[model samples]
Target: MTPLIEADGLGRSYQQAGEAVVALSPASLRIWPSQRIALVGRSGSGKSTLLHLLAGLDQPSCGKLAWPTLGPVESLLPEKVALVFQAPSLLDSLSVAENVALPLLMAGQGRDSAARVAFALKTFGLLALVDKLPQTLSGGQMQCVAMARAIVGQPKLILADEPTGQLDQLSAQALLDALFRHLADSECALLIATHDPVIAARMDIHWHMEHGLLSCGERTAGSV
Candidate 1:
């Protein structure tokens, strides 16, 4: 089967005060349909940087990247690949329902956008807060809303960065349950970046990141 995304020695770096600072070491991996992957690392370990490159949010400084099954990089968002950031990233002016509906609207699914948004919110137990604003909700609620937005379009892949950082254990588990339910029997794949060992254990594949380098299988000693 064709991989949803494939990266060959992909890496990123930044110029810091006339010095080259490596954010990500050259790393290669493939994300297949229906795959469950956990990117385990501590803060500043390049987990977010790698996710950004894979989601086409940041340009890689080296190696190659491709979306073999999803399509071109420019056309991979809000339709083929969705992102849930560490922060909630909701528009304060927009209601919860509207926040969740934005992706569908952007994808030109305006006709049934409300229905889909409602369904997504319901999945995250946010249906009652549909009319609420971002500032009015708690941190966990906001994260749930962000998750609802990510799934509203039913994209092929979801890349989440530190998604459960602000949530309690129960809330985090509930969110994961909802996400897995959405992925069941579908081509959708999930790749989550987290420092939680319990969360990492839940996924089928575990990848480790440290000091900008990436590796599969057993995690490195003293990492995350």
Candidate 2:
């Protein structure tokens, strides 16, 4: 099968204090449809940098990245990819439902797409909070809202960074259940960057990032 995403020697760097700082070392990887990948790393380990590059939110400082499924595109399409950042990133002015619906609306889905929006909210157990604003929700509730928004558009690939960082263990488990359930239904690929060992262990494939380097390895029993 053609890979949904491909990266060849992809890397990123930034100038800080008049010296080049490598955010990600040259790394290559492929993601196919319905693949669940976990990018594990500690803070400042370049996990977010790699995810941003793969999502097409940032350009690689060197090398190449491509979405073969999208066809001849220099960058990814919004409708083809959904990214959930570490922060909730919800718009303060929009209600919870509105925020979740924003991506669909932006993708040119008409107002009749309310059913899709409702389903997403229901999936995340946020149906009652639909009318609430971001400020009214707790941090964990806000995270659920963010996840609902990411999957609402039904993007082919989801890149989530520390999605469960704010939630209690039970809420985190519920969120993961919803995510995998949706993935099983849609066959959309998921790449999540998290520091939690348990979260990484649950993914089908695990990739580790450290000091700007990336490595993919087969799952080992009780590996941390």
Candidate 3:
């Protein structure tokens, strides 16, 4: 099977008040098409740093990331890759449906944007609230709207950074279940950063980062 994403010796660092902080250590990783990989780690463990790199939202300071790395890479397309933030990133200024259609519009998409937005809203059971403002929804409902926004573009890769962190247990589980089920039926691959072992245990594989170093299998020893 072709690995949809590959990071070879990928590294990232930041300058915080003139002090260098190593956000991600040089690490190699791969995920095949339709693969669901969980990333578990404690706070400050570099999970979010890695998710950013994988999603092509940010580039590595050193090393390389190849798209469709495992096989048949035809072309590298932008927006075909997506990132889901921990918080509901919906625009309070736009209605839920309009918020969901932003990416498509940004990509210069046309009339079908409305249809695609409706489909995404239906998937997350947010169709009834399509005309509501983001600020009016409950936390879980807000996040559902955010998710509908993420998947409405037909992305091939989805990178989630503790997407359920702000959600209640029931809501978190429901969203995760829906996301994984989507991956199973579609050709997309997901790499998620999370603290929930209940969700991690259901993953195809997992990676734990510690002090900017990538560790496979079990989490950083003694991690929560």
Tell me each candidate's TM-score.
0.96, 0.96, 0.88
Predicted structure 3: lDDT: 0.78
Higher-lDDT candidate of 1 and 2? 1
Give lDDT tens digits, candidate 1, residues 1-224. Answer: 99998999999998989999899999889899988889987788899999999999899999999999878898988888999888669998999998888888888888889788989998888889999999999898888899999999999999998888888998899899988887787889999999888777788888988899898764344444
List candidate 1 stretches off by more than 4 Å. Answer: 218-224
Sort by TM-score, best first: 2, 1, 3
Error of 3 at 49 (Å): 1.0
lDDT of each: 0.88, 0.87, 0.78
lDDT of 3 by residue, 64-167 (tens): 88876523332323357777887668788999989889888877785789888998888777789989988888877877777787788888887877777778
lDDT tens digits, residues 1-224, model 2? Answer: 89998899999999999999999999888999988888988899899899888888888999988898965543354577888988769999999988988887787885776899899999988899989999989999998998998888888899999999998888888999988887787769999898878787898888888899999776767654
Q: Candidate 3: which stretches are off by over 4 Å?
A: 69-78, 218-224
Which window of ten consecutive residues has the lowest lDDT sum in model 3? Answer: 69-78
In model 2, where do residues sit more than 4 Å from their true spots? 72-77
